[model samples]
Target: MTSNTSAAPRAARRRWATLLALFAILLIGAHLRFLSLITWDEPSSRLHPDERFFTDVASMLHVPASFDEYLDSARNPLNPRNYTKNNWYVYGLLPQTLTQYAAVMLSPQQVLPACVNRPEYSDPSITIGQPCQDTSLADYQRKIVNPDLAVPKLVWLQQALNAEGRDLTGYYEIFKVGRTWSALFDLGSLLLVFLIGLRLYGRRAGLLAALLYACAVLPIQLAHFFTVDAATGFFVLAAVYWAVRCAQNGGVISFGMLGLSIGAAMSCRVTLATLGLLGVLAVAVRLLRRDPLPNGQEDTTDRSHTAISSPRQVVTLSLLLAFAGGLALLSFRLLQPDAFRGTSFIDVLPDERFIENIQRISTFVSGEADSPPQQQWAGRTPFLFPLQNILLWGLGLPLGLAALAAWVVAGWQLIRRGNLAHLLPWAWVTFYFAWQGGQFVTTMRYYSSLYGLLCVLAAWGLVVLAAAKHLPATRVRVPSMVAGRGVAAKHLPATRVRVP
Candidate 1:
C-alpha cells in the first residue's frame, strides 16, 4: 500500500518534469525560428522570388465587405482566380489571404489607401517625390532627411510607396509579418512532433523528438522565409497525428479531427490531398480491429474482432467515414473556395483554371518545361538525388542515418509484432518519399513534412536502445520469505517499464 501510494507521487512528479522539459524545448524552437525572422530586405535588396510574388499577390487582394461578397465566385477577392492581373495562381490561397489580412491588421498605417481622387497616388508605380493623400504613408515619405541618407531607408520608403502597383504600401512589412507566420507554423510542427512521439513511445522519446526537430537546420531555415512550406508541413503533421488518433480510438470525434486536418493540409498544397491515403489506411486498420490500446498495450482478444461483428457495426463505421469525408469537403471549400468556383452544390468539381494551372505546374515539376531551374536537375539521378540532399542538408548526416536505421527497425517490428505505432508513420513516410523522391523538383522544403515523422522514429529507436541497455537479459535468483515461513529462491526475469 505504501509503495503504491508513493508511486503515484513519483508518476505525478515525472509528468510535471516532462511538461517542464517540453516547455523548454518549445522555447528553444521558438528562439531558433523567430531569430531574425524578417530578412527579405536584409544586407541588400535580397527579396526572395517566392516572397516577392506573395507580397505582390497580397497587394492586389481585396477583402470582401460581407460574407455574401466573399461567397460570390466571380468577384471574390479571396479566390485566386478572381485576380485577373496574374495568371500564375498555382499556390494555395490560404497563405496569400492570411498574410494579406494579417499585414493589414498588424500595420494598418503601413498600407497606403487607394487615393482614387488623386490620380498620381492612384498609380502606385509612379514614384512619390512628395507625400500622398494617405497621411499614414506620408509620414514615412516626410521622414526623408537628406540626399546622403541610408540607401536601405530610401529603398524601403520607395518600395512602400510603389507597393508593386497596389494600394498596400509596405511590401517589407507584409513580408516581415508573413515570415512571423511561417515561424509560427514551423513551431506548430515541432509541437506536433512531440505529441506524436509521446503518443507512440513515452515522455522521454517525445522530448527527444521535439529537440531533434527544433534543432534541425532545414526547418529553421524555412522558418526564416515567408512561404507555404512550413504551413504545409504543420498541417500535414497535424493530419497524420489525428489519423493516428482516429486509428487508436475509432470514434466520431477523432475521425472528424482527422478529416479537418487533412483538409487544412491540402489547402496549403494540393499534393497534400494524398494525405487522404493515410486517413484511409487508419480507417482500414481501425475497421480491422488492429488498433493498439490507448496505453500502448496489445489486446490479444481483439484478434477475433478483426472481422465485421455485425451489419449495424458496418453501417455505423460507414456513416462515421461519410461524416469525415463531408467535413473534409466543407473545410476545403472554406479554405480554398476558388477550387469550387465552377461547380454546383451537388456537382463538386474544381475550377477549370485551377485544373489548367495544376496541369501546367505538373509539367514544370516533371522537367517537361525547359526552365532555368530545371537545368540543375538535368544530370541528377531521380530518387537518389533527393535522398542524398535530405541526408546531407535536410537532417544532417547523423540524424539522417539514425532515422533511416530507426525506420528499418520500425518496419521489422511492424512485420514481426504488428505494432501499429511503427506502421502508421511508415505508411506515411514510405508513400510521401515514393511520390516526392521520384519528382523532378527535389527541393529540401518538399520533404519538410517528413521531419516530424522521422524524428519520432529516431527518438523511439533511442528510447528502445536505452531500455534494452537498462534491462538485463538474464535473471538472478533471490531468496524470499512468505509470512513467517522461509521460501525457496526463484529466478525471475526483470520486466521492462515505460521510459519516464
Candidate 2:
C-alpha cells in the first residue's frame, strides 16, 4: 500500500514535468516566430513576387462582390473573339474562394460593404464606349501577374473588390489574418515531433528535439512567414508520428490516426502523398519481419477468434474507420479536373518526362544553374546555406559547429547500432539534399525541413554522448604504476591492469 502510494506521487510528478516541458517548448517556438514577424522581410515589398499573388487571393476571398466579378471574368477571357489569344490566370481560385467565403462568414458587414461599392473598371484597351479592344488594361494586369497562364480567378476577384470601394488596407488585414493562422500550424508540428521523440527514445530526447526544432533557423523562417511550408511540415510530422505509433501498437486506433495524419498532410501539400506510401511500406515491412509483441505472440500471427472480439479490436476498428473516413474527405480535391494539370503527377509517372522534370527542379533548387537572364541566384549553396545562415542569424559559429558535430556523431552511432527505424527519417533529408545539390538556384528557405530534422538528430546525439560520459567507471590498478615502484619482494603486490 505504501509502495503504491509512492508510485502515484512519482507518476504525478512525471506528468507535471512533461506538461512543463511542452509549455516551455511552445514558448520558445512562439518567441522565434514572433521575432521573425517583427524583424524579418515584409511581404509587401521584401518578399518574393509570388507571395503577393497569395495575398491577392486572400483579399478576393474576403469580398463577395469581388467573387461574382471574378467568376464572370473567368468564363469570358480577355480576347473572347480570338480563340487562340492567351489569357494568363494569375491565382489559385480554390484558396481565394475559400478565404472569401470564410471572411464573409466571420465579418459579413465589413466584407459586404467593401464588395458592394467596388469601382467600375474594365481592361483599359477595351473602352466602354468603343468596341472592346483585343484586350483590356485589367487583362494586361492579370496576364503580367500570372505569366503561368493558370488560375485567373484571384485577379478578377481583386479588381471587383477594388471597384467596390474596398481599400487595399482592409484586404491586407484579411490576408495577414490568413497568414497568422497558417503560421500557427507549425506549433502543432513541433508538438508531434516532441511526442514522437519521447515515445521512441525518452523524455530527454523529446525535450531536446523540441528545443532544437523550436529554435532551428529553417523552421523559424518558414513559420514566421505567410506560406504553406509550415502547414506542410505539420502534416508530415503528424503522419509520420501516427504511422510509427500504429506500427508499434498494431491497433485499429493507431492505424486510423496514421491514416488521418497522412491524409491531412497530403491535403496541405499534395507532394506529401508519397508519405502515405511510406506509411504502408513501414507497416508491411514490420509485419513481414514477424517481430514478437511484448506479450510473446508473433505480431503477424492470427488471433481472430478471441482478439478480434476484444475491446481493443473494437477500438482499433473504430480508429481505422475514422482514418479512412478522414482520408476520403480530404481527397475530395482529386475529383477536381483542374487540380494537378500539366504536372508530372497527372501526365506521367516514373517516365522520362517525370525524370527530366525532377532533374530540372533539382537543378533549380541547388544553386548550380546559371541565373535566368532576368534573375540571379543569391549565391546560396544547398549544404552551406543553412549552416552559414543559422550561424550568422541565430547561434554563433562555435555553437553551430558543435551542433553539426553532434549530429554527425549521432548519425554514425545510430548507423553503428543498426537503428534503421531511427535513420529512416533521414532518408528524406538525404533525398532533399541531393535534390537541392542538383539545382542551379538553391534558396536558404528550401533547406528548412532538412535543417530542422538534423537539429533534432544532433540533440539526440549530444544526449547520448553525455550519458556515456557520466557512466560510473570501475577502478583498477595499472601496470605502469608497479613499474615505477621498482621490484620489492615484501612491499610489492601482484600488478593488475585496468580494464576499461
Candidate 3:
C-alpha cells in the first residue's frame, strides 16, 4: 500500500517537473518576443516595422479581399493599382494571409474602404489605414472587438469608443489578435529547444540551453515581430529534431516527419531549404553506413532512441519522404497561387522574382557582390557571432569561450576521430555558419536557427566540462581540457572512455 502511494506521488512529481520546465521556457521566451506588446494604458501593440505591416493590413482583408494590400496601404495607398505591385507579393504568403483572414473572421463582414487623406492636406500614406471621416465607423464595433457585456461598465465604454472615428478599436483588436499567433510560434521555438537539449544533454543542460536561446538576444530581437525568419527558425528546429531522429534511428515515420518539417520550412521561406538538404544528407549517410551513428540521442541522458536494422525500414522511409514533399508543394501552390504562378514546386526558383531574390541573397552573402545600401551584410568574422554575441555577451567570456571550445572540440573529434554520431549536427552548424559568415550583411535575427543548435552544443559542453574530473595520477585528460588552438579528435572512434 505504501509503495503504491509513493509511486503515484513520484509520477505526480515528474509531471510537475516537466510542466514547470515548459512553463519557464514559455514565460522567458514569450517575454522576450512580446516585450511591451500590451500595456495597462496603451490601446495598440507597439510592435516592430514588420509587425506594423501585419497590423495595418487587418483593415484591407475585407475592403480589398487581397492580403497583398499591406505594402500598398503603407507605401502606395494612393496608387491602389501599384500598391501590391511593388514588393508586397514577393514575401511568404501563408503567414500574412493567415493573419489577414484571421482578422477578417474576427471582424465585421463589411468594412469600409480605408479613405486616403491626400498629402496636400496630410500625408495620405501616414493616415491611410485610419478610420474614414465620413463613414459611421462605430456601426461595426460589435463585430470587431468582442465585448465583455456581462460587465456593464466595460460594455458601455467599448460602445462609446466605437462612436468616434478616432477610436480604431476594431483595427487594434484585429492586429492584437494576429500578434498573439506570431508570439506563440516564436516562443514555441524556445519550447522545442528545451526538449531537444534535454534529450541530447541533461535536464540542467536543457534548462541552460533554453535560457541561452531565450536571452540570446537574436531570436528575441526577431521574435518581437511576426516575420518569415521567426517562423522559419521554428520549422528549421523541427527539421533538426526529425533529422536527429533519422540519424539515430532511420525509420519510415522519421522521414515523413522530416518531410513535413522541411515542407513547412520551405513554405515559410525558400532559403530555409538549406537545412532540409542537410537533413536529406543526414538520412543518406545513416543508410549507407553499417554502424549508423547516433545523432546526440545517445547522450547519458534518460531517453531511449530507435535504431535501423532492416532493409524494409530504408525503403519505407524513402517513399514517405517523397510523399510528404509532394504534399507540401501541392498545398503551397494552392494557397499561394500568385507566388507560384502555376509553376511546379521545383520551378519556384526560376521565376523572375525568385531570380532577383537569388541575386539579392548572393549579394547579401558575398561581400564582393554589390548590394543596396539598406541590404548590406555586416561582414563580421563567423565565429564571433556565437562566441561574442551569444556566449560572451550573454553568458560572459569564461564560460562562453569554454562553450565555443567545446563546439570546436566536437568538430575535431568528428573529423579526425571519426565520431560518426555527430555528423548530422556538425553538418548543420558548418553549413549554416559557412552561409551566415560568408554573407556580406547579416543580422542577429539571421542567426536564430543556427544559434538554437549551438546553444544545445554549448550547453552540453558546459555541463560535461563542469561535472567531469580526471582520475588521480591520470596521464590523459578529457579532450576538451587539452583542445587548444584547434581539433574534434584524431579519428572517429566508437570506444566509450571512462575517465573518472
Candidate 4:
C-alpha cells in the first residue's frame, strides 16, 4: 500500500487507540482511589487534620435551607466559629461550597450537636476527686484516633450516639463525597494529559503520557483526601490547556474560558496562582507575537474575524480577558460581603492581607514557621528533595530522567521560538521545581498537580528520540492560521520508520 493511501485508516486507528488509552487510565485512577476510600476503618479512625478543616468548611459553606437548620448549626458548641477565617476566605467558597452541595445530596442526614454534648460529672462511689464525667468530643475523638483503640469509653460513646437515632454513617459519607469528586478530577487531568500530548505530538505520545499519569503515585494519593489540591491541579492544567487553545484560536470566548479556569484554580488554592501565571505569560506572548485572531480580516466588515495583528483586535481581546477576570473577582467577592471591601480586585497586590500572606508564606518557606519534625530535616537538603520525590520513585527512574530532560529541552525551545502554546508545559515544570524545591518541607504529593504535565513531557521525550531515529517520517505544526480556508489545527500522523 502507498504511504499516503493509508492516512485515513491510520488516523482512525489513532482515534481508537486514544479511546482505549482513556478507558485504561480512568480504570487505574478509579481503582487506586477506591482502595484509599475503603482502607480507613470508620469505627476507630479519624480524618486527617486538614480533612477536618475541609469538612467543617464544607458544612459551614453549606447554608441551611430552613431557619431551624440554621439555628441548630449556629447553636452548636462544637462548631464554635463562623466561616470568617480571613486566610481561608482566600481559598474559600468554591470547593467547600461544591463539596457541601455534593455531600447534601449524597448524605442527607447528620448527627445533631446535642448528640455530642459535654459530659456531666458523677462519681460511682461519690469520692471527692474521681474522674467522673462524659468526655468532650475533642478528647473523645483523640481516644478513637488510634485504629486499635481499646478504650471502652470510646465504644460506649459510639453506642450512645447510635442509640439516639443519629445518622452514624452519614458524617463520614458526606466527607467522603468530596473525595469521590476529587478522584473524578484526577481522572479528568489524566484525560487532559493525553489530549495535550496528542495535540502537541501524536498518538504514541498521548497514550504514553496518559499511562504514566494514571500510574503515578502522587495523583493516586491526591484522590484519597478531600481537599483543594485535586480540584486545583485539574483546573490549573485545564487553564493552561485552554490558554494555549485561546492563544491559537484568538477567540474571545476561549480567552474568557481561560480566565474562568484560572479563577477556579485560584479560588481553590491561592498558591495555584503560580500555575495561572504560566497562562498569563503565554497569553502575553500571543499578544506580543501579533498572532492573528480566528477570523483574520483587515476590513471593518467582519469584526468577529479581526486579527490580533490589528490594534483594534488586540484591544478587543484585552477587553474580553478583563471582563472574564472581573467576573472571577466578583465570584470571590460575593463569597464574603467584606471581601476586598471597597477595594477593586486589582488592588489585591497592595492590600495588607496580600502582603501579610506573602510574608507568612515567606516565613514558612524560610524554615522560620512551626513545622513538623519531618520538615526539620528538609532544611538540610532543599533542592534534591523534589528531584528525588517527583522524578525518582514517583515517576520511575527511566521515565523520570526522560521527563526531566524533556522539560529542559522544551524550555530551551520555548526561549528560542517564543511560541505561546508551548510555554505552559515548560513554565509549569520550572515553577513547581523552583517553588517546591525551595520550600523543602513538603511531601511528594505537593508536586502532584504537575505530574500530568511532566508525563506529557516524558512522552514527548520518547517521541523526540523516535524522531531522531526516523527523521523523514515526522512533522511538527503549531496551528498558525485557519481563516476562510478553514484549515483546523490537527496533529501530523505518527509514523514508524525502520533504519538499516
Candidate 5:
C-alpha cells in the first residue's frame, strides 16, 4: 500500500519532467530556426533562388474577387502555374500560398502605396485593385513602429508600389514573414516527431528523437529559408504519424484522417504521394496479422476461427482502403484546387503542367538543358556525391552514422521478425535515399522530408546503445589466507557475457 501510494507521485513527477523536457526541446528548435533568420547571408542576397521564386509569386497572388474568378484556371492568381506567363511552376502551390496569405493578414508596412496619391492610376499587371484607404498602423491599435496589422491593405499597396516602378519595395518584410512561417512549420515537425516516437517506442525515445531533430543541421538551415522544404517535410511527417495511428486504430475516422494527411502532403509536394503506400502497407500488415478489434487487437494464431473471419477481414480492409483513397483525392482537389482544370480527380493526378515542369527541371538537372546552372553537377557522381554530402555536411558525421546504423538494424529486424516498427521507417528511408541519392541534382534539401524518420531512427540507435549491458569479466582473482602464513591467490567464478 505504501509503495502504491508513492508510485503515484513518482509518475506525476516523471510526466512533469517529460513535459518540461519537450518544452525545452521546442525552445531550442525555435531558437535555432528563427535566430538571424533574415540576415544570415547579410553580405550576399538573403533569398535563395527557390525562396525568391516562392516569395515573388506569393507577392503577386491575391484573393479572387468572385467565385468565377476563383474557378478560372487561366487567370486565378492563386495558381502557381499562372504566376508566370510560361506556366513553369514545379513546386507545390500550397506552402507559398499559405505563407503569402498569412503575411497579408499578419505583417504590416509603414510606406504607403504610390497609388494612394494617384487614385486613378491602376497596375495593369494585377487584376486585383488596392482599396485606397488612409489607414495608419495606429488605427489597429498596434505599435506603428512594429507594423503588425492592417497587413492585407499594406501588401496590396506594396504590390501597387512595385507596379509604380519601385521594384521589390517592402519585400524584406515579406521575406521575414515567410521565414517566420518556415520556422513555425519546422517547430511543428519537431513536436510531431516527438509524438510519433512516443506512440511507437515510449517517452525516452520520443524525447531523444525530438532532441536530435531540434539540433539537426539540415532542418535548422531549411527553416531559415523561405522555401517550401520545411513545410513539406512537416506534412510528410504528419502523414507518417497518421498512418501509424490508422494502423493501430482501425476505424473510419482514423482512415479518413490518414487520407486527409496524405492528401495534404500531396498538396505540399506531389512527390509525397509515395507516402500513401506506407499507409496501405500499415493496414495490410494489420490484416495479415489477423487483428480483429478496431482498436489494435493483438494477433492470434487460433486456426479454428481463421477461415470464418479471413474473407470478412479482406472485405473490410478493401472498403477502408477505398474510402481512404476517395478522401485523399477529395482533399487533394480542395487544397490544390488550382492544379485541377476541372472538378474531377483525374485532372489532379494527370497534372500535365506539373509534369512538364518536372521534365524541364529534369532536363536542367541531367544537363540536357545546356544551361550554365547545369554545370553545378558537372563532376558530381549521383549516389556517392549525395551520400557524402549528407554524411559530412547535411546531418554531420556522428548523427548520420547513427541513423545509417539504425537503418541497417531496422532492415535486419524486418527481415528476421517482420516488425512494422522496423518496416515503416526502413522502407521509407531506403526508397527515398535510393531515389533522391541517384539523382544528378541530389541536394540536401531534397532529402529534408526524410530527416524526421532518420532522427527517430538515430534516437532509437542511441537508446539501444545506452541500454546495452557491458561484457562481464571472464575471471576474477581472489585472495585466500593459508594457515596465517601468506595470502594465496584463488580464482573466483565469473561468467562471460555473450552477444549473439
Candidate 6:
C-alpha cells in the first residue's frame, strides 16, 4: 500500500514537471515572436495588402450605407483600371464611413459630410518649382486650402485620442496592436499543436512536437509579422489534425469537423486546397483496403482493387450537415464576383505573368536572378532562412536512413508489437518532402509544413535509437544458447532445474 501510494506521487510529480517544461517552451515562443514584433523594421510600403483589405471590410461592417456602396462598387468591373487604381477609393471609404457613423452616434455637430470629393494626396505641392502653376489662385487663398482631409472614422479616432489626450498619428501604436493580435493567433496555433500531439502521440511526444513547432524560427518570425501566412498555417495544421483524428476514430461527427476545418482553412488561404485532395485520397485508400467505415459497416470484399466505398456519399452527407450549421464560410474573393472577373475553376490556370513571377523568384533563390535582388540576402542567411533551410531541412535525410535501419532490425518487433497508426504520420512526412522537392520555388516559408512533419519523424527516430540502446543482452544470449543446444535440450530440461 505504501509503495503504491509513493509511486503515485512520483508519477504525479513527473507529470507536473513535464507540464512546466511545456509551459516554459510556450513562454519562450511568445517572447521570440513579441521581440520580433517590437524590434523588426517593417518595410514602409504597404504590408500584407490582403490584410489591409480585411481591416477595411471589418471597419465597414459598422456602417450600412458604406457597406452597400462598397459591395456595389466592387461588382461593377466596367472600368477595371479605375477599380484597380482607385482601390483606395473603395478601401478608404470604409474607414471614413465608419468614422462618420461613430461621430453621429457620439457627437453630432462635429460631424461633417462624407469626404467623397477629397483631392488626391499626390496633388502637386507648392514646394515644386512651378510658380506659374494655377495662375488664377492668389497666395492668401492658397494658404487657406486644407491639405489634410478628415474622414469620418479618422475624425472619431481623433476625438477619442483627444479625450485621452494622446497623439492620434502614432503609427507605431496601430502596428503594435496588429502585431499583438497576430501573436495571439500564434499562441492559439501552439495550443492546437499541443492538443493534436496529445491525441495522436502520447503526452511526451505531443509536448516534444509542440516545442519543435513553437521554437521553429521561420514560423516564429512569420507569426510576428502582420501576414496571413501564420493564420493560414494555423488553419492548415488544424485541418490536418482533425482529418487525421476522424480517419482514426471513424466517426460521422469527427469527419464533419474535418470538413469544417478544411473549409475554414480554404477560406483563410486558397493554397490549402491541397489538403482537400489529401483527404479524398486518404478516404479512398481506406475504402480500397476494405477498412471498416466510420459508421461501423464492413466494406465489401467482392469489389476489385480499384473499387472504393463511396466517400462521396459519406462526405456529401457530412458537408450538408456542416453547411446547415453555418460553418461553411465562403472566401471573400469567392463572394465578391466583380474583383475576380467571374473566372470558373477551369479558367483559372497559372497565367504567363504568374509563371514569370515564379520563375523570377526561383531564379532569385538559385543565384541566377538579378543582382539587386541578390543583395537582400545580406547576413541573415545560413543562420536564418535560405542557408538554414538548405542545411537543416535535410535533417530528414539522416532520419530516413535511421528509419531504414530500424526497418531491418525491428521488422519482427514491429510486426508483433508496433502500432500501425504511426504509418500515417510517417507517410505524411515523406509526402511533404517529396512535394517540396518537386516545387519550383525553394523559399523556406514554403517548407514550413515539411519542417513540422520532419519533427515528428525525428522524435520517432529518437525513440527507435533509445530502444536499441536499452535492449537486454541477457535476452539475446538466452535465445542464442537455446538455438545452439539444438534437438535434445527440451527433452533433457527436466533433469536439472536450478534456482539462481
Task: Write model 4 residue lDDT over 416-476, tens digit each, in one string.
Answer: 4332335667777787778777774666666777788899888877765666556645544
Arranged by TM-score, best first: 1, 5, 4, 3, 2, 6
The per-model lDDT (C-alpha) reads: 0.68, 0.47, 0.53, 0.56, 0.66, 0.43
Q: Identify the runs in model 3 with alpha carbons over 4 angstroms from their true place.
A: 1-16, 38-85, 88-90, 108-178, 288-317, 331-336, 343-351, 354-402, 470-500
lDDT for model 3 comes to 0.53
lDDT of 6 by residue, 1-500 (tens): 99999999999998898789878878977887777574576554335554454333322222222222223322222212122233332211212222223333432223322221111221234121112233345443222221112223344644553354332222333333445555766776776666655554445656766676676666676666544556556666776666555544345665566666665555444445556644554354344333324432222233333454586756654454344233323332322222232224223233232234345555655556657646665445333353345345433345434434433333332233222333344455445555554443445665555444444444444543443356522211111001111101110111211111
lDDT of 1 by residue, 1-500 (tens): 99999999999999999999999999999999988776534864436677677766665554544454344444355565655466567888777767766555443343344331211112244322223345555454432121111112233553564355332325545667678789999999999999888766666788999999999989998888878888999998988788777666558898898789878887888877788887677766556553224543324443333564367766776777777777877788777766765334443576777889899999988988878867887877888998898788999999998898889877765555444556578889988899988888887788988988999988877766665556666322211111011111111123222211
How many angstroms is residue 393 displaced in model 2 relative to the true structure, after the best TM-score fit? 5.3
> For candidate 4, what is the lDDT?
0.56
Candidate 3 lDDT, 25-46, residue by residue in tens: 7787777778864442265454
How much does each candidate deviate from the true structure in C-alpha RMSD? 9.8, 13.2, 9.6, 10.7, 11.7, 12.9
Q: How close is candidate 3 to the true structure, as a TM-score?
A: 0.66
Top lDDT: which candidate number? 1
Query: Model 1: which residue pairs collide?
Result: none
**Regions of candidate 6 where Cα sits further than 4 Å from its true position:** 1-19, 42-174, 250-252, 281-390, 393-436, 471-500
The positional error of residue 200 in candidate 3, measured at the CA in angstroms, is 2.7
Regions more than 4 Å wrong, model 5: 1-6, 83-86, 107-170, 290-309, 342-352, 365-368, 470-500
Better of 4 and 5 by TM-score: 5
**Candidate 1 vs. true structure, TM-score:** 0.80
lDDT of 2 by residue, 214-332 (tens): 87666776666555566667766776666656545446666666666665555444445556554553453243232223532212233222122346544554555456555634442
Each model's TM-score, in the order given? Answer: 0.80, 0.62, 0.66, 0.69, 0.77, 0.54
Q: Which parts of model 1 have CA positions greater than 4 angstroms off?
A: 109-169, 290-311, 342-349, 472-500
Q: Please give the distance, in angstroms, between residue 29's alpha carbon in candidate 2 and its true position after superposition.
A: 2.2
Q: Sort the candidates on lDDT, descending order.
A: 1, 5, 4, 3, 2, 6
